[model samples]
Target: MKTFTLLQEVVHIPTKKKGQVITTKVDREGKQMVEVKYENGTTGWSIPEALTNFIQDSVDHTGEFLSD
Candidate 1:
């Protein structure tokens, strides 16, 4: 079976009031997929390529964190 490793990062979402949690996923090819879930159980997906930058940044941060 062909297997692909999944990478994930948690990002802060600006909410109407405060404290919103958003999840983002990045594939090996730099494709970004996002999911946002509301307290009411509503959810949505976004395909903004802007997430690639965030994914890279997070990966760098993780490496730094692990090295320390």
Candidate 2:
């Protein structure tokens, strides 16, 4: 499990919001999926690649930026 903040708003997953990725998994079809916990207490599944700019960084999760 890990946390992540979006670089921009994604409106299609129930609402246009920002959230932290709580879990990552590979489905039976071999596709990568991520479970995100929105700021509003909602959870949804999406592909990591689907996120516009979801990049991983070695910096602290508490930091404001996830990438350069």
Candidate 3:
């Protein structure tokens, strides 16, 4: 399974809120979705691609948090 752990905080576009990407998975539509735990303590899922404006290309390190 593919996944990612964002090293820095990012804004979830749909909510226009800043949060950490605590988890990720490929959803039913085959989109790489992120489950963000926002600063408000609420969580939401969305494709990180939409937040590209601030999330530079290098920060997207797939499976970087996985363990053996």
lDDT of 1 by residue, 1-68 (tens): 11112334323233332112365677678776566444455665545432232344445443334453
lDDT by residue for model 2 (1-68), tens: 22234433433234546677667677998877777777788988887655533333323577466586
lDDT of each: 0.42, 0.58, 0.68
- Clashing residue pairs in candidate 2 are none
Error of 3 at 63 (Å): 33
Error of 2 at 37 (Å): 0.3
Better of 2 and 3 by TM-score: 3
Residue 23 displacement (Å), model 2: 0.3
| TM-score of structure candidate 3 | 0.58
Name model 2 segments beyond 4 Å from true.
1-15, 53-68
The candidate 2 region of ten consecutive residues with least summed lDDT is 1-10
What count of clashes does model 1 give? 0
Candidate 3: pairs in clash: none
